[model samples]
Target chain A: MKEFKYVITDNEGIHARPAGELVKLAKTFASEVKVAKDGKEADCKKIFALMGLGVKKDQEVCFKVTGEDEDAACEALEQFMRENL
Target chain B: MKTYSGKSVYGGIAIGRIHVYKKNESMVRREKIDNPDAEMERYERAKAEAVAQLKGLYDKALKEVGEVNAAIFEIHQMMLEDDDYNESVENIVRTQHVNAEYAVASTGDNFAKIFAEMEDEYMRERAADVKDISERLLAVLGGGSAGAVQSQEPVIIAADDLAPSETVQLDKDKVLAFVTVHGSTNSHTAILAKTMGIPALIGTDVELEEIDGKFGIVDGLEGKFYVEPDEELLAQMREKQQAELAQKEMLQSLKGKENVTLDGRKVMLYANIGNVKDLPKVMQNDAGGIGLFRSEFLYLESDHFPTEEEQFQVYKTVAETMAGKRAIIRTLDIGADKKCDYFGLEAEENPALGYRGIRICLTRTDVFKTQLRALFRASAFGKLAIMYPMIISVDEIRRIQEIVAEVKAELTENGTPFGEPEQGIMIETPAAVMVSGELAKEVDFFSIGTNDLTQYTLAIDRQNPRLDEFYDPHHPAVLRMIAMVVENAHRENTWVGICGELGADTELTEEFLKMGVDELSVSPNYILPVRKRIRETNLEA
Candidate 1:
């Protein structure tokens, strides 16, 4: 499993578009992915699950990736977080 | 005759036969099925058909309301495809040995309970969406229509609150007006009716079953629905109907005229469109230009603040389509009757006079600049002008100018292409009328919003039915205000226009011409009629 952490900087943090983009990205990989905030975890592959997490700004979010292509998933998510969220 | 009252969502006189749309009959029964597998197969078939119906609605809504409002259908489609929802239906059928209808209804009830229990208020309200989708599924399964409504002739449709999909499925030719017992002015049905210029009344508890196939009149301007009127009332309505028909016939013949007076006084007749989707109707009406492009539609239509590029694309399309004719895009005029959940605006007791229009823009320069930047960038496309709504002072105009300057500097620094366009204000307040001269000195023109101006000047909330008796647009105070505003604009060498329902008042066409009013911006339906009025008018006569 590959684990990573990032703090959301955008005031409207982890909003619809980025969350939708993250879900679409996670689904492209064979690996399992999950995003969590304040110990509440949501399967990152599901758009509704990620949105329901309601990760607001200045809050820390953790991502866990497993199975094949986990490295690729982690790299893509990190880049997305920097560029979007 | 039975009369019911509701909020007047759109203004007109609709006299027609009834076309009651029974959207849901709610006849779910708890009978046992002989085989669980058969019941499940029945549900699977219903689900497939529901998906197909939903897809059609999604595409239509996308065209009608743009991408954001249409996202509800996407979420609905996903809900239909969710494993949990399907599993709940299958399990209930398998375990209880019940009919698919019972199982489906139970699933909706059970899931709604869960969503209603959520801590987030918005999440709680999403129970409505879950119920909306479930109702669609059950509606399809029960052999209920997925909107195959047919009326051989024109009629007024009375219904319960119509779903967005159901509203989209209505035949434009068949529907004359809409009357519902439960809905708000901001509901999809109300907005669509207003956009189509169909009369509508909402929030009335009229029993459609009792009056089905009866003659009725939806008096939208008066906020009342009348069923099976007496001869005298019927005669009055017939006269009104003939007048409307005559007006339409007269307007149709002047479609290509230059909206000029018989005495050779020329004025521009423009359309006030809410969004990019309205552009086709604007063009179809041959409006000389777009006078009031309500930019708040962008913010109102989105789940979040619309990106600058998103706004720019809409502005560019409208400007390019108008092709050098003025497209006066109004900055965000949210608040009052219009609310945006994303804007986080504080609720006010008197929103019409509260933190709206220039107040919100001046305070939240961030929101203001994003719109300005997009508008400025789109100015390169065609004759684009910017207008602000509810400006009541010269100081406010100065502050707004500073922000516009900042946005211009930023755009220039970024090497963006934009033309210097005319800037204007909406003369909608008494104070705006009082300061018209100082305000005109700061802008290129004025466009009066008579609805709010009348309400504000008279201190009568026209939306409140109790005040309907006192709501008079013809009151001398309003006429004087218009005359004063026009006089002030001319003195400043600036053009002034009226983008209000009063602008389409044919009786006042010569009055406005006499006042030297340069333009009249109205809804698309009024464009041709107002143009014809201009053609017949003799200002000097």
Candidate 2:
């Protein structure tokens, strides 16, 4: 299992569009990814779960990945946020 | 046999059986069920069928309008899958032994009723969505096709509210006018009707079923509907219709010509665009230039504020398309009413009076800076001018200039190439108008945001139902303010433009030209008419 922390850079924070984008990215990997912000954790594959976290701009969130592709998942998710979010 | 009068918001005369879109009642009948397991199975089957039916409707919509509009159905799909919608139907079907169709219909109707009863206009409009979904589901259950419009002749559409998709299906030549029991001027249906040149009267208390197949006249401009019109009234309406058609033909003839007055005083007719999606319409209208390019659409429907590159792509497209014609881009003017959860702006009690326009931009420098950088970058591609909205003071204008200077300095230091774009301020507030002489001296140009200006001058809360009656752009005070800004800007040799609904007012086009307003910026559809109006007027003293 690997855990990494990043701040949301998207202007709308982790709202519907970004959450959907994140979920789509998470589903591409075999690893189970969970995102948590301020003690609220959500399955990275579900848009509603990510939205429920109510992450705002610049707010920090942690991502934990578990599975054979855990390192790859964390690396890819981090890079995705850096590039797009 | 009842008649209620309202301002005719769109124009046409029609005689048709009013098809009262009543809440489907049969869906509410409860059935007595004996076996829980069988009931549950039946409920699931009904939901599946309804969902499948909804999917088909969505696919049809996709084929008709494109994916963005079809995406509106995604909300209905969500509602179908919602715990409240699905679970409610499931519980009723299981407990009452009702068929899945009946259960879903009943639950949908109940929800629609609740929404219809809501006091908030936005919430009340949700009832239409409920009705839309329910109607789609019922059609599926009945084995009827989607995209069905009544095949009757010369009908007037009366509904609680008409969705944009539904309104698009209406054949303008066949349908007379639209009368809605509830709708706002800003509703998608109204906006679309305006673009399509259809007459619509919204917010009427008249029940549609009572007037079905009745001869009626709808005056969209006056927001009035007349049922079973007398001979004299019908004759007068016919004459008026002929005059309007003649006027429209005259306007159509003015297309592809520059708007020069009778005495040869030229006035630029431009379009106020919200997004690149509207570019095609702008081009079709042969607009002189883009008067107001609302940049807020970039932030809307996105996860984050658009990056400089993303912003560049949009700005570049609009600027390049115009090909040296001016494109006045307004910075993000979002506030309480047009809130973005991404900005983390706290909900203000009075959003209009609260932190909005230049206020939000001033406070959130990071957000403002990003937009400035993008605008500066896009300036290289075309004739671009950055216009700030809701400027109430000279200090605000100075602060913005300071930031622009700072951004320019940074860009220079970083070796980023950019063209200098003219800076302008939207003189919307009473304070802005009051200080126009001082503001005119600082800015390259000025555009009157008359919508906000009128609202502020009359001390009327435009969103307040009680104050709507007082929200008039033609009020003497509002006109004087516009005249004031135009005079002030002209004195400084800076051009002034009017970029509000008033700009498109056919009657006021000559008045605006006389007031020394350099340009009138309106919606794309109004370009030809406004140009024609301008061409007919003698502006030169």
lDDT of each: 0.82, 0.75
Q: Candidate 1: which stretches are off by over 4 Å?
A: A1-85, B23-25, B34-39, B63-69, B117-125, B150-154, B248-541
Compared with the true structure, model 2 gives a TM-score of 0.51
Which residue pairs collide in model 1, if any?
none
Compared with the true structure, what per-residue lDDT tens digits does model 2 show for residues B413-477? 97666778888989889998888999889989999988888888898887779877666768999
lDDT of candidate 1 over B175-205, digit per residue (tens):
8888888876655566556545567888987
Best candidate according to TM-score: 1
**What stretches of model 2 exceed 4 Å from their correct place?**
A1-85, B1-3, B7-19, B22-71, B77-98, B106-131, B163-165, B170-173, B249-291, B294-327, B330-526, B529-541
Please tell me what DockQ candidate 2 reaches.
0.15
**Considering summed lDDT, which 10 consecutive residues are worst modelled in model 1 chain B?**
B62-71
Candidate 2 B-chain TM-score? 0.56
What lDDT does candidate 2 reach at residue B197?
Answer: 56
